[model samples]
Target: MDIRQLARGTVEWDRLERVFRTLAERYDRTVVRVEFLEADNWLSTPCVVDDEWFVKIVTRQNALVHALLTTGRNVGAITSGTGGFFDRFETPLGMVEHEYEATKRMREIGLNAPRPIEAFEVNGLGVLVLEYLPEFETLEELPDEVVRELAPELFEMLATLHEHGLAHGDLRAENILRCRGELYFIDATRVLEDRVAETTAYDLASAMAVLEPRIGARETVDAAAEYYGSSDLLSAREFLEFVRFRPDHEFDTTKLRSEIEKVADLDRG
Candidate 1:
């Protein structure tokens, strides 16, 4: 068994059926077909219902994992010379509710996101429903040329989020979806509103980490330069080592630092 599967535990078949049945009753449908996604996700069991709604079934185990991840992320923030900024949830409903609100806020800010339908608890599971996108690809699955083309747009979106005092506490290739030539963000985690600078820098570092390997450090920094000032890039540089500690992020950190310093120097000159 995969370690993550073991860690995530399994939702009993009867419980899952109860969830589906509840969904059907809530949506006024006589029946619904569910297609489970084998996603590399630690927090939820994802599925598509009747090809119309994307759903996440969050269990007690998922909430435990989320708490653990939040602790680890907060520790990483401390190592990067900032206080703990990540928020933790005590229940599956809290996790789903936070994500639902975050997605709604993204769309409200003119950013692309799946439209949130509802979040509710059924049979001890947190169920979140959203509009399903039939066609899409993750940033990691896109071609290098496409990623290069989208890099600046990615920063533009991030900048807009930062400008509005919001941060995507989780910014990775998989969390970014390219659907029909537009980018859609998902799975934004909660962060402290009072620690805006620290969260902003961390988000920028995560974004560059996502792009650096595919687009090269120079181009990644170049893309960031368009939307962020040299100081913001420098702030992000502080968290590169911290971001690298995560298993999902792997990039040439040395090269990235050099590129950022070069850009900073040019701005200074």
Candidate 2:
């Protein structure tokens, strides 16, 4: 489907109005109304609301809102004229569709992720509303013990996806949520068509590189290997190799790689 049609097919404005009305009635509190919030050259327009929840309208040419609606995070949402790789590619609605499909496949495999509530098209926009998760922090901010306890399960989830020929385009710590002693994967955009081993390996390695500092290098690599049953899937050395290519602005990755190598060497010896 064309981009506009894809946007309109995802959410129904009437349905959104009904949903908002129901939420307002249930919450019994006036929704905090405000203009769009802009930061870092991005804008999240407040579209609809209730006291505890509201729909954020993001204005961009891409299907980022649709992806978030289907996959459960807003990582793909880009800012116009922000200047980067995103500026060159037309936001493909197919990506949004693929993410939704991936999330459905993941749920079938018993992976932990945010449950998608509903998807609909509203006023030339694709909107997805999901169960709001409260009181959670991204894995990036969690403690090492938490990462050790959590990383294995998440890795297993990734392994399961790989087995099914699926890969999360972005698998960083911030895309993972910790709630009530469990981790939930979010943001399934960039789901590609290829089932190549390198695709899956890169995903695992990238995730390991991003999380190593929080979880430690040895634990990160070991957990991934253990979960995938392949030491080659993401080794400490491979993680270091990949880190060097990452842009300097990726401070977390640069720092974690340094720290993880020190710990990994000690474990090896």
Candidate 3:
């Protein structure tokens, strides 16, 4: 709808509530019963309904722009703010469709991600309902010892997602969870469709974005490599590069290609 207005600032709380109400009515769910998952937060807020489903509204413009910009460059289209940028994500509804499809695709390949429940669009916001998998704790919530033991397992989860031809675009530690004994990846919002080496590489590099701080970079990489097995491994130097130039909502990867050069260097040695 209003591209200029939306891009100008963050979505206001009152406005988001209003938008949520309008969309919730279409689902025949009462707004009063829903408790906002987190308040005083900046990004999308997911609400748990009867502890069975997690629902949220998202436009994911930044993520969509990254995809468009990446694909555009390959075809040599205008990078950002050009006709292509706005044209691609003109409908937040479409973005939701991508996320829904991504979620379903993950389940199709036997990956442990929340299953999509229902989806709809009202005005410009897209509404999504996902099956709730309760009793999960984020990677940040674990003790150092647990993180050390789970790092390899965490890496394998990502590896499995990749091996099945899917890339969890948002692999931040918070998006990763430990429930029971398994690692369940949340926020498959920015999954990759290209399914190429670069897409998978960018996904792993994004993994480094958070893993480095909590459990140390090289340690995590080595552990992940042990389980990842066939997929490429990141060295200390490559990891350093990932931190600097990892993918973002901005859709720039000039640094990612440069980092790919040193993957063969084996910085560990």
What are the TM-scores, per candidate, against the unseen true structure? 0.99, 0.61, 0.67
Estimate candidate 2's RMSD in Å.
9.1
lDDT tens per residue, model 3, 108-140 = 877677888877775566777888778888877
**Candidate 2 positional error at 84, Å:** 16
lDDT of 1 by residue, 1-269 (tens): 88788878889999999999999899899989999999898989999999999999999999999899999999999999888999998999999999999999999999999999999999889999999988999999999999999999999999999999999999999999999889999999999999999999999999999999998999999999999999999999999999999999999999999999999999999
Q: What's the lDDT for candidate 1?
A: 0.95
Q: Of models 1 and 3, which has the larger lDDT?
A: 1
Better of 2 and 3 by TM-score: 3
User: Between the candidate structures 1 and 2, which one is better when assessed by lDDT?
Assistant: 1
Model 3 TM-score is 0.67
For model 3, the superposed segments whose C-alpha errors exceed 4 Å read 1-32, 39-43, 59-88, 229-231, 234-242, 245-269
**Each candidate: RMSD:** 0.7, 9.1, 6.8
Worst 10-residue stretch by lDDT in candidate 1? 1-10
Model 3 C-alpha lDDT versus the unseen true structure: 0.58
TM-score, cand. 1 vs. native: 0.99
**lDDT string, candidate 2, 155-254, tens digits:** 8777877887777755666668888777777666553355345456556766776656666655776676666544444243343444335432142555
Error of 1 at 128 (Å): 0.5
